[model samples]
Target: MGRTKPPRLDGESEDDYYMRLIQKLANEKLALFARYQMEQQQEEEERKEVATNLLSLKKSKKSSLKRKQRDFDEDDVIDIKIKNKKKKKVGVTTTNKAEQRPVVVNKVTEGVKEFIKNKMKGSDLKLLIQKTLYASDLNPGQNRLNMPANQLETNANDFLTADEMRKLTDKDKKSGLEVDKDKKSGVEVGILGPNLRMYDRMLELKIWDMPCTKNYVLISNWYNFVKEHYNFLKKGTLIQVWAFRLNEQLCLALVCPDHEDDNVAFEENLHDGENDDVAVAASASEV
Candidate 1:
């Protein structure tokens, strides 16, 4: 061998052994630094390659844009000729008439009209609001029915007289003017149930005008009306509210299309003078 090797030590406490161990660790550190430098150099090369490729792609895009512009100019000449031909044929092209579909009349809505005419003897009946009820409408604590201005089937002004409309839109509330109960900025309208029977009391229809939103809400006796018709006035239930004049008093009919059968039966009972039980129940609800 190249010079006799040192005798092996039982433990690594010998000076030669300690020197060898230190040399091995130093070599490992040097190898790690070499690998780190290689990785950094490789990354720099990759970055330069990517930059050069991007520049080449940008130049290619510029050339393509010029080519497209030339093609577009040629196409514009062709498009002008095509437009001239289309104009010549414009008068000869006959338009197809839209197919007319059969109008489907809702039976429940027709029934409501009949009820107003026969039972209530009401006139000027019109669909006021058609909307699906939400939790706010059925909430007991709220004790009111909200009808957004936009949800009205027709113009809101159509439903009220000039004086009534003026009262509702008046800004006197901010002036702290004392308003009489009869002169309050609301119309007291009687509420009819889905069965076409009026509630014991009337509900006040008022405009709730705020800075960002406005609504026509029914207050005062709304809680009793909801409690009486709780089963049919749940959330998500679609209802049509019809406004009419009964004996010169403003009245509304609440109709549920799904409960048309019940309404038919109630109407029959009323005609046969056999609705005494319903009348008694209605009186009890007042209490």
Candidate 2:
């Protein structure tokens, strides 16, 4: 038989003692959980505040710039003052996604210059390219993606509808590739061939840098997505990509697996399952 210890005199009852201990532990755990919830609430409030503050700030900055421009039509000195004001770092400027730019074109000869170059063949093609260049929406100096409604042309109102270089007859070749056009649908489609350098060049300019995995979507501001080359799904195709950087400079890209090929490999494995089982049995015998 096990020996029982004697109870202490002047001590609390056993049930009372254990209940107190249980309550103490419960209190501590509750305190911890309360602290976690408080922290989460505070973080959410802070994020909301930041987003609101940034939107208002960007609006103010734009208004201020417009006023200055209006007042001084030709005063270089006033312009210099405004420039200096921006240059003076007053901490993070109020910013917004409304004016967020995807890419700059004028600084890079506008995105559709290749189409313009092709217009030189005889004067007829030249006129078409000329109208496209002059008649289309003029990009805001600040953002190539922006096109005021008035600037859009009759034939090609949206940049998406116009300037589909991929659709130009293969009979006249600037770039060598076959484009599958849908006659019934009146739309063009295909995966974009990889232009690996596009991302690297942006990085070189310190424009953007980010890594994409899963479905890395490049929402081009000015490219014709309808006729985009989807050949990345081909057996062994490759291309470069681009992204915006955290710091206005140092944009970069990396080589990543194409999801299209992953699908192909999965199907191939299914077909080879029988062969794999036979090989496994032979290996088991050898062991």
Best by TM-score: 1
What tens-digit string does per-residue lDDT give for candidate 1 at 1-287?
A: 46344565787667878698678669657645533443343334334434544455556665535553434333454345345544643212111112111222477678668766765456888887776576667656556676656456668767677876766666555786534322347877877788656677868887754222346778888878888887788877778788877656667778877665556554664465344433533343343
Per-prediction TM-score: 0.54, 0.20
Please give, for residues 96-140, the per-residue lDDT of candidate 2 as tens digits.
233232222231222112211222111111111111111111222
Best by lDDT: 1
Model 2 ranges off by over 4 Å? 1-10, 63-287
How many backbone overlaps does candidate 1 show?
0
Instruction: Point out the worst 10-residue segment of candidate 2 by lDDT.
Output: 206-215
